[model samples]
Target: MSEILRLDAVSRHFSGLKALSGVTLRIDKGEVLGLIGPNGAGKTTLVNAVSGVTPASSGKITFMGRDITGIKTYQAARLGLARTFQIVQPFAEFTALDNVAAAALFSQPGESLKSAREEARAHLAFVGLEAQAGQSAATLTLAMRKRLELAKALAMKPKLLFLDEVNAGLNSAEVERATQLIHQLAASGITIVMIEHLMKVVLNVCTRIAVLHNGVLIADGPPREIIKNPAVVDAYLGHQYAQRNAAHG
Candidate 1:
């Protein structure tokens, strides 16, 4: 597969604390890569760095063969890099359609409100939120809000999408729905990097897995191999997961 993004020894520091340390990675086009880790393992920081929410202190980030280490968040969005936040924060007062329309307007230059709303409708429909389009965002259920976040990201027309804990607070059925959406997105040929805690969801949707622990990448491989990796098991997956996987295997 062709490379879509590359991070060469990337590091990010906040007040002398290394949130990310020499994290080098690469993403291929149309890949569904799961970024898994325990809490505070720098998974989100790495996504922030690549998406330009937080600029890296050192090393390079290349997207589509061009360096974007210093690109701003808006610039990154315009360049077809979009991400959904772990905390789904939509404009409470805005209608669901308007919330997505705002994203479309912001990411694409010269997009009129009318044109943006038209496009937002399509994106909302894609995420199964068409019926709630006219409803106030604050009135939506958590599951609907999560789908709204996805609709908003889709409005940006991203080539590479970062999904940060998209299934964190979901129930089993909701997670299944979200997983199906992710499968659809991947099947549509978008390169995806998902930071997820649920091993089942990660294993189900991701083609490969990358594990982080205390700001370092300890494992990278196919799910079957990663689940058996000693360092990954120690750092995040734990013995129980391994045993359960073995039982299931």
Candidate 2:
């Protein structure tokens, strides 16, 4: 598989506090890479920089062999990179189809509204929102809203998709559905880089897992090894078990 995206020595600072430190990673064609970390680990920041939601302090970002550093978000979208926000932001007043249509409009190549809406309907169905297409986005349940967000991102027809904390607020069943959809997307040839808090979701869908702690990458390996990393256990899982273990000890 070819390299679809590369982040070289990526670093970001806010008021002298480092949010991401020399984070270098690559997304290869047809791979699902998981970004896992405790809160404040800079997982979202890394995604933001790649998606051009924020300018990186120092880094080189390349997409499909083209330098895309500091490019506008929409331009990045046009370049076959799409992303979903941690917080699902839909056009509340619009129908599910309309919300997707808005995304399609932004992704439209030749500036035709008709063609965009036509494409949007297909994406909504792809995310399993076809039955709710005519309902207002505001009226949808949380799970449905999440699916709509996925549909909106998919409407961009991305070669590489960045999902940030997509499973954060979902129940087990919803997360399972989301995971299956992600698998489907991967099967259809979309390389995915997902930042998720739900360990199960990451382990189930990702081929490789990348762990971050205090804005630094500490582990990059398969799920089995990653979950066993002493560093990862120290950073996130220690507190939950240390007290209990001490009580028993």
Candidate 3:
């Protein structure tokens, strides 16, 4: 697979406090890479830097061989990058269908409104929100809102998708369904980079895992190998038993 996204020694600082420190990673087309870390690990900051939600302090970001560092957020979207916020933000006044339609309007490449809405409808159905399409966004439950968010992002037809803590507030069953939805997205050949706190969701949805601690990437590898890294375990993998054993040994 070709390299779709590259963050070369990327760093972000907020008023002298480092949020991401020399984070370098590459994502290939059609790969699902999990960003796993404890709270305050700068996982979301990394995503923001890549998506142009915030500019990086240093280093470089390239998407599809083009320099995209410090570009505007909408530019990132237009460059085939899309993201879902940790907090669901739908247009309260619009119906769920219109929320997705708005995204289509933004993504429309000189397409008509009728065409955009048609695509939006398909995306909503893909995310299993076809029934609630006409319902107002403010009236949907958390799970429905999440699905609508996915539909909106998908409507933009992004080559690379960033999901920020998407499973943070979901129940077990909802998480499972979300995992299935992610799998379907992956199966359709979209590359994904997600900041996920739920280990189950991370392990199940990602073929590779990247672990961050204190705004630094400490480990990047397959799930099995990442789970065994002493640093990763100590930081976020819940391996206290192993750490205690090693201490005794």
Strongest candidate by TM-score: 1
Cα-based lDDT for every prediction: 0.95, 0.86, 0.89
lDDT of 1 by residue, 1-249 (tens): 899999999999999789899998999999999999999999999999988889999999999999999899999999999999999999999999999999998899899999999999999999899999999999999999999999999999999999999998999999999999999999999999999999999999999999989898888999999999999988898999899999998
Put down candidate 3 lDDT per residue, 24-79, tens digits, no spaces: 99899999999988899998899899888899999999999999999998888888
RMSD to the true structure for each prediction, in A, is 0.7, 3.2, 2.8
Candidate 2's residue-wise lDDT over 119-143, tens digit each? 7789888888899989999999988
Better of 2 and 3 by lDDT: 3
Between candidates 1 and 3, the one scoring higher on lDDT is 1
The number of the candidate with the highest lDDT is 1
lDDT of 1: 0.95
Candidate 2 residue-wise lDDT at 213: 85
Error of 3 at 8 (Å): 0.7
- Could you tell me every candidate's TM-score relative to the true structure? 0.99, 0.93, 0.95
The TM-score between candidate 1 and the true structure equals 0.99
The collision pairs in model 1 are: none
